[model samples]
Target: MIAGDPAATGRPGLLGSVWPFWVLFSAIYLMLRWPFVATGRFIDPDDELRLVQMRDLLAGQSWFDLHQYRIDPPGGVVMHWSRLVDAPLAAVQLLLRPLLGPALAEQIATVIVPLGTFAVILFLLSRLAARLVDRDLAGYCAVIAGVSFPLASQVLPTRIDHHGWQIAAALAALLGLVDRAPRRGGALAGLSIAVGMAISLELLPIAALFGAVLLLQALRGAEGRERIGAFLLAVWAGSVTAFALTRGTDLTNYCDAVSPVYLAAMTIVCAAGSSTAVFPRLTMPAYLLILAASGGLALAAIAAINPQCLAGPFSSLDPLLGTLWYDRVAEGRPLFTMNGVLVTQWLVPPLMGLGAALVLWRRASGADRALWLDYALVLAGTVLLGVVVTRSMALAAAFAAVPVAWLVRDAAQNLPKRRGIGQWAMSLAVPVLAIMPALPAQFALTGVEALSAAPAKATAGAQPRAGNAPLQAQDLAAIGNLPRATIFATFDIGPTLLRTTHHSVVATGHHRGAVPMRDVMVAFIADPAAARHIVVRHKARYVILAPDLPEISNYREFAPRGLAVRLADGEIPDWLVPVPSATTARVKTFAVRY
Candidate 1:
């Protein structure tokens, strides 16, 4: 039997113990996340544009011509061959759209894919935590914490981005590494990092932090040499794979920019560090020397790349403080909501560690303490790196969850054993209590929705009756069947467009690339002249406006100069431009020139 395999015990079956975990996880996640996913709740002003890029990729747009709908703002978010998650979503939708049809495929990809991935990762985290705590009770707690943590709730459903896969990848790597199965652990870690890099570069620092912690553990004890060696080798292999996968036409450009010099330096540092595990007597000296030399080199490299790395926190302190305090507010979102409770997530790891510390305080073996400490350090380093740029909080949270699970598992194991009614009640109460913190927020948002009946009615009154169908499956099917078109649409509409239609959008909520598209989107919302110019420049065939939604501001001045089609339940408006199909210039004036 594979070590730590629950099946080895000849237990009833995986499902007997697993079903309750899933039920609890699903209940909490659905309650908090369902509305966002169902309503296609995309609020970040850039959602529709990124969907355009995804749509084009599904339509067989060339990798070289990755930029679709050319009027995209300069340096706009582009999904450059980052096939880690996008490939599967696009391929599944494409295959199913042709067979089962666009509507079904879209629904499946949006609802099923995100939820299914979350389930798998939560299961693994629970199992891994069970191993650390050596009991089933702790496993249950870890699973609950994994699924119910506020940070996990926010990111798992509402933000249907590639970060989900990255989290799963990191969890898998930790499972392998924590178990001390070097080759397997190393391989998983490497592959996870590579996949993370492909999905989003934001994960690199977190991966590095994880690697450093593992390396430190390997340097400290007798078994350190082999473990460290395995980790370093795994990291190198993963990097090579990631580079191979992502570097196509950009190979030369990336090669020129990514120094072989730095690569070699890293390899040397890794080799020396890995070597210390073999020579225990020489471990401390070798480690200190290696640390000093490597630290010096890293400092030099940082100076070379961006002297800002060495700049005492004060140098870039203003941006950090502004970001922590006011920048999110400046963007017209609550500081708590802008990035989905990023600051709050930081507190989770420590809480988890405290729980673990309580359980392990006197009971844990020396080796286990070392393991936990290593992970704690790694988590801390990851947070620091992630905080440097708030966009990385999702990845940071991914790292944080592991320790939290470990600690929660340990705490649960320490709980006094009970029987019968007490046991059953306790079992039910644990998950409920774990998820209670999330209830207030979910209830508040839903409560706000309830209290806003006046605005809802006002919106209903103002909208065209025909657009009120809530973007049905049939409308999506019809749009998907049409020739690929550039569209003007709201952010909420972008993912559905990517999932169902053959059209490219001007934006999506992915803020990374929305920097360029923001100005155009604002113009579309607040200025009619600019909107007209943008429509002409992109050769947009259709402009979709949701009248009942406050997003009506986004399409306000876009006076339709062409065929306007009011589809059924006309709460939405679809305006068609009658200009020649290929016209690339603005219609400065529609009045007759004669």
Candidate 2:
């Protein structure tokens, strides 16, 4: 038996025994994450954008209003985000500001809030691991989670995007699903799913999977019925509560954010769940009939209310916007299409975890079978999601830690008992390889380096200087120093410009900001006369270009004879006057000559 197995050793409750371990793991995580926090190196544009939103909130933007006024002027873009995330960030900053001063307070809040969120995720993962395996194995799982590259990347200090919170909410729901108690567990799961959906529709896939699991469990027996019924009630109530707390007063818009469509669907689901619980004696075939009827009715109701949403939120997006902006986001790409380094970074750990899960499933018996099945479901769902979009890799890595921990613990116990150098090597290698991507990453790096070495060497000198490159704070700061005016910039660079500079940007990476994003794209790829008209129409005072940006390549490809291509080829347009910069020459600025 495993060392901490409750069946064999009569251990206490999982939560009661795991508090100290959580503290230790949290401390270790803080230490691990401190460097990134201290250096203030936010990896994603989303993180910077989050800071921008938080700063705006602190500057006294209405709690219900999530518009970024700087982006589209007086009207602004309605950011499809909940104010729930901003509350904690603002509270922390306000609390710390008097003691640390404004800048320091903001920095501390940036580092601490995400780390705190990460700790909660670690605790939840540990709890799930303990239930799936044993207490000792759970500690190992926490360690694996602590070191998970994809998970860490999102939760690192200075990274304050909704993704980390969404992952936490998903894990919370997963934990609730595995909870033994019927009503309480179901409610918890329902509430978590509701909170996740309230945050963003990104959680829809996993949320739907969890709902299916609950419904299936309900169909199985009496206890399942009670759980599912409670879940449905909580989902309906929780979604309504979440929407009330987070959404703006504009209740009519069903296209983005939680609206009447979701409320109606949840209401129907609640009715179906309640019927199952109230009539537990119903036959399987009868129950199936009732469920199908209720679900179909719910779909029909939602379709009647908002047929546009039946196709999904982005259904109304222009084809050009999809082609030029949405499709190009790196996170949305498939794992197979990604470079070897990314593929290894994402797939290896999850694959290891999947292998371990399969091993455990074969050996599991009695009550443990149910627990392992839950783990398998989460692992499978997240792995499938990761295959579709690399962003889901973080979630897959997080869920994978449990089984990976089991593999490591099993190897440590059985292999080391043997008496030879080979035994030592195998045992040491197994745990190390299971925990870290270092070994597989080396193999991936070697091939990738070989394939791209010549190109890298050729472009090394032509590449922008370190300080002036897009995403560099210093470069954006230099742009900010110029008179505060609406700047027309590439889609990729817009977020950083908005976050770092005082000037309003014509476009950013957000899909909701598609109007200006489309305008900017057209301006870049259109004729000089057409581009000038767009710039003037948007009242944009400055045009900024970060040479060799990926968007520029797209622009050149789409319109070979356009102004952007001419600029790229060193042919300056007569109507645009180049502005000299003392800071860095890599970023070129042009003022429209009216």
Candidate 3:
């Protein structure tokens, strides 16, 4: 019998109920995160920006208007982010606004949205782990998913962004793969894939992977045919629905987002795939021919819509911005390019899960073997994709939970049953294991440092520098009451100021604002005289920088006479007047003397 089967024996036990599991999981999550929850600090700029988007939506920004009006002025950035993520955050804030006031309402929204996402994940993973593992171990799967460091990091109370939602969508897709009803399973997986890709194009590869898997199954028989056709239809319908709802009427077909090109591509591919699935008995040669033709047609359609997007999302980014900003984005970069100390933490847990899945698949028989085979394949894809895109590790971590839970179960069984001081010491390891999906990741860092013969710049669990936190301080709040005008500052500071203060900014780290991003970098590192012209050209009324920001330090080191460096050294330019009242010792603020 499969794990957590309701009808496996005479009756299912206490762990059979999903509600009890969710409650215990939530209790554990809340207790572990109480301190961070109390502080309510967002560790990433995206979280702050997400809150800003929610505020804009609640403040009656047009449903169609995804632009950040405070970013880059008159023609502000038309954010590529979909409105689906912002909707719930806005809804929660609206419901509580009258009762708690706006500030408290937003605070409550931040806490609720992420936790709600966890609940969805809990529901899906419990069922999925039960089907794949032992029926009794399903709750363990949900618990592990909740506590897994890589996965939990995205859903913690203050992490109110689309990332946690994306992980949940990925988990739902995995669950659909193992469902008993083929048509229902395929439809669920397809819709989840569409939702994820709508939220972020980073999910496109996984969508394609699902299509391939379903099509491969199609070669088997009528059931496979039904599955693939249902998946294709669902994806096409769901993608169109999501696009209309999220994109509204703006069909400008931007290459960065899910534009008309992607729609057209998906349509062509789904049509071809569904057509090939019509026949009752398909030969191997016919299946290969159909797959190749369908893929080719889809590629041709994309090229017809916008050939540049064929290169990828960042293809249109300015070369200067690519070097100065986009390439330096730590999370978006490849796993190997990141800090060596972190490579182990990013890779080990997922790899361990994959290993566990392989071992189980080898030992299983018949139907169980087939289930494990599917699980292993999906885990392999997610783990590889996560390595290529570091931010995607959460997807891998989510899928890995089932196998990791099984591993945890096996470990617990081996724990010393007889009680003694030494046995108690051995028992302590289980709780430590529950805390982080991969506890040895810490030791792995020591291994990396020792092997490299040089310590990495930072440790695996290193916290952000306190002095670098310009967003959390009263210094930025001091400028909150100022007139709504552009603040010409480094990309890192732009989101902070936009979220904390009522002001616009020249550029943010988002790649879509490439032109303004280039302008900001050029203005910072150019000679003071040249810099002022660039700032004035953009109609910037103020210049600002955090002296210790990595970007500001880069400017100071690369060009000693640059405006940013000059400002850092307290060598105030003649055309600039300091805004001392709104400035801090770390953050320099100035009024442009145009």
Q: Residue 94, candidate 1: how far off, in angstroms?
A: 6.4
Residue-level lDDT tens digits of model 3 in 142-260: 77776676788787777887888898888888777766567888889888988998898878888877776676667656777777777887888888999999887888878877889
Predicted structure 1, TM vs. truth: 0.64
TM-score of each: 0.64, 0.91, 0.89
lDDT of 1: 0.50
For TM-score, the strongest prediction is 2
Q: Which stretches of candidate 2 lie over 4 Å from their true place?
A: 1-41, 419-426, 444-470
- Residue 64, candidate 2: C-alpha displacement in angstroms: 0.7
The best candidate by lDDT is: 3
Task: Please give the range of 10 consecutive residues that has the lowest summed lDDT in model 1.
Answer: 585-594
**lDDT, each prediction:** 0.50, 0.77, 0.78
TM-score of 3: 0.89
lDDT of 1 by residue, 99-185 (tens): 788656754566555666666665656655454543354345446445544346433443456656767776676665665555556
Model 2 lDDT, full chain set? 0.77
